[model samples]
Target: MSGSDIAGLIAAGVFAVLVALLAVPIVKLGRVFDELRSSIRTLSDGATPLMDEVTSTVSTTHEQLKRVDGIAANVSDATANVSALSSLVAATIGSPLVKVASFTYGVRTAWSQREDSSRPSGRRSR
Candidate 1:
């Protein structure tokens, strides 16, 4: 009815209009937060399975590496055994074979020298 009362009413109406205008962006912000939450939930849901698969893959690789380590250890042991066996065979057979070969060479050399001495002037007819 008065000037001050009319001005207050106009101010309240303007405030209401401003609230209504700003509520559009607030509502849209709420919807964006909801979409972001849904996307995060979806990504977590997908990533759980991917992480499980990665865990299983790592477990499988660890198991395979353990098997490979065992195989490598066995190969190493076998190689050591082969090396020891070769050394044993060389010690057992190599010395006697060398002695026998040396004796054979000496006999052959003596025989050849005797035949040469029997020939005239150490020259063979051939």
Candidate 2:
């Protein structure tokens, strides 16, 4: 063959080899795109159940918090009522005791004053 024809044949062979090399990367890219699609679908499927569980848990937590708040309010009200009841009981029971104590103290003071006046200051009583 002539030199120009041989050079043309070599150029055609090199072009074919470059095309084959480029085809391998194209096929690999197609597989990578397929894997990406499959992973996205799997992630989307998993998110549905995860979101449902989170929603249910949040709703349950809200209900429990409401119950706890109700119980706390009831406890606060009960504490206030108990405090008032204790004060009332103290007032009712303590007033009579205080009056009795004052009356006893006054009687003791009067008796002591009378005894002191009846005694002669320098004489020892038999």
Candidate 3:
């Protein structure tokens, strides 16, 4: 054979060896990409359900907060009603109680003064 044909054969052998050496890493890279795609799909599937559950939880929380607000309003109304009722009771009962207390104080003061005046100084009336 000629020198050029021998050199061409050697070049073809070297190129084939290089391609075989590079193919293993290329195939492994393709497998890694496939695994990554599968994991992404799995994560997406899990996240969809998680997001739906979160939405439902938020809806329920909003409803509960509305109910709590309504309860707070009811408590405020009850407090106002109780305050008005207490004022009404005070007006109904306190006037008579004050008058009676004032009359008792006056009677006690008058009786004590009369007794003191009727007794002599440094002497017991009894």
Candidate 4:
């Protein structure tokens, strides 16, 4: 054959080898696409139930939070009432008890002084 014809034949052979190499990657890509499609279908099948469960749990949590808020308000009101009652009792009862204690101490001291003075100093009994 002539040099130009031989060069043309070589070029055709190179083109065919390149086409064969590209075909392998194309087949691998098709298999990857098929696997991706299957995985998407599986995810879609499970998503509905998972979404339902999440929504239910959220609603339950919201209701429990509301209950806790109500309980906290009640506890706050009760604490206020108890504090006011304690202050009132202290004011009403604490002052009288203090006065009585002071009066009793004064009386006991005066009686002791009188008994000591009635005894004669420097007089001995035989």
* Count of residue pairs whose backbone atoms collide, per candidate: 0, 0, 0, 0
The reply for model 1, stretches above 4 Å from the true place, is 121-126
Worst 10-residue lDDT window for candidate 4 reads 117-126
lDDT of 1 by residue, 1-126 (tens): 999999999999999999999999999999999999999999999999999999999999999999999999999999999999999999999999999999999999999999998879955688
- The top-ranked prediction according to TM-score is 1
Candidate 4: where are CA atoms >4 Å away? Answer: 1-20, 108-126
Q: Which of 2 and 4 is the better model by lDDT?
A: 2
Tens digits of per-residue lDDT, candidate 3, 1-126, equal 999999999999999999999999999999999999999999999999999999999999999999999999999999999999999999999999899999999999999999998888895768
For model 4 the TM-score comes to 0.66
Clashes of 3: 0
Q: Per-residue alpha-carbon lDDT of model 4 for 1-126, expressed as tens digits?
A: 999999999999999999999999999999999999999999988998999999999999999999999999999999999999999998998899899999999999999999999987896877
Better by TM-score, candidate 3 or 2: 3
Model 1 has an lDDT value of 0.99
Clashing residue pairs in candidate 3 are: none
Error of 2 at 93 (Å): 2.4
List ranges where model 3 is wrong by over 4 Å.
Answer: 81-100, 112-126
